[model samples]
Target chain A: MMTTPSSITSNELNFLVYRYLQESGFTHAAFALGYEAGINKTSIDGNLIPPGALITFVQKGLHYVELEANLESEKFDGDDDFSFLQPLDLITKDVSELQ
Target chain B: MMTTPSSITSNELNFLVYRYLQESGFTHAAFALGYEAGINKTSIDGNLIPPGALITFVQKGLHYVELEANLESEKFDGDDDFSFLQPLDLITKDVSELQ
Candidate 1:
């Protein structure tokens, strides 16, 4: 199981999401999210972050969560059974419910 | 409609995919893809890419394709109707079929 980097703060994630929404042409959504998330206060370099970064980070995070769940159940066979599972289910459901 | 950067070569994309497969723990798949795509010969700096770069790039590309399709039909009201469409469907079907 991979450990998440402690360096990645919530603000960075929020900024990324805000940028993604703007890039995808969700101006109203982006503006709302930016306001709620306080993205204007972030000091992140927008140019350094490539487009789709938020989606990529979310996908990787989901995979890590699935991997952790598999390990805890002693079913860590390295098979990617949870690869197709949607992110929302994992986020909303208890970890035990996944197994 | 946004124009995809001409600087993004197919080799760069292949390398990103290769790195993504490796990061996701699909070792055998990564090896096969690397060999087929000649990723070993690519000079891309691995450190520059954050995890999930490939997924991010693909999502952006899919968005662009959807945007272009909407534009051609003169229905480019900035409404994101095709936001939920899967990447495979766009890749396999004709652009006209999407509408």
Candidate 2:
């Protein structure tokens, strides 16, 4: 089906499921699916992040917004000349490094 | 902080939250966060998919696996000569077209 048009195959979909299970910390499900589907051949091991990362991700984001609100109030209120050369001072690490 | 070490900036994290809210169909949340963070400058608009897509993704994947099981039992049982030149008969579309 790789040569077909407008169709998605099972392999691609299975990969998504595998990743979902892993990321959600359904380890047994991930393991079973990977084994059955032969998806482990692609070396998807050891990439599982703790399921709590999702909560951390959201809370961290909220904190950032709060900090931004405080900073903008203090720093940008009277500074008509202020322009963001880069939008936010977030992302200290390089994108490649994160990946 | 962009040049700092061991830090993730707010913008990066906010973008993630924005995407999460959008993809999860919390459009109002995504919109609010994007507006506050000035993330809309990057053109993340109109990429929102309904929350149902996640369910559909899993169901479709489960169906694929079921079909594969049926096919393998029928086609591979007696075919010791059988080797998967390609793993599954999935993904009719080119990867490029997907993106």
Among these predictions, the greatest lDDT belongs to 1
lDDT digits (tens) for residues A15-60 of candidate 2: 6544544564545545555566677665433333333333333333
Q: Which lDDT tens digits does candidate 2 get at residues B25-66?
A: 445444555565577675433333333333333333333333
**Each model's interface RMSD (Å)?**
18.8, 15.1
Off by over 4 Å in 1: A1-7, A32-41, A75-86, B1-99
lDDT of 1 by residue, B1-99 (tens): 221112334555456545655775555545555556666777666665667655544444445444445555557355545334444443334457666
Docking class of 1: incorrect
Runs off by more than 4 Å, candidate 2: A1-4, A42-99, B1-99
- Cα lDDT tens digits for candidate 1, A2-70: 221123344554565456556655555455555555678776666666676555544444454444455
lDDT of each: 0.51, 0.39
Task: List clashing residue pairs in candidate 2.
Answer: A9-B90, A9-B91, A90-B9, A90-B10, A91-B9
Compute the lDDT for candidate 2: 0.39
DockQ of each: 0.02, 0.03
Model 2 clashing-pair count: 5
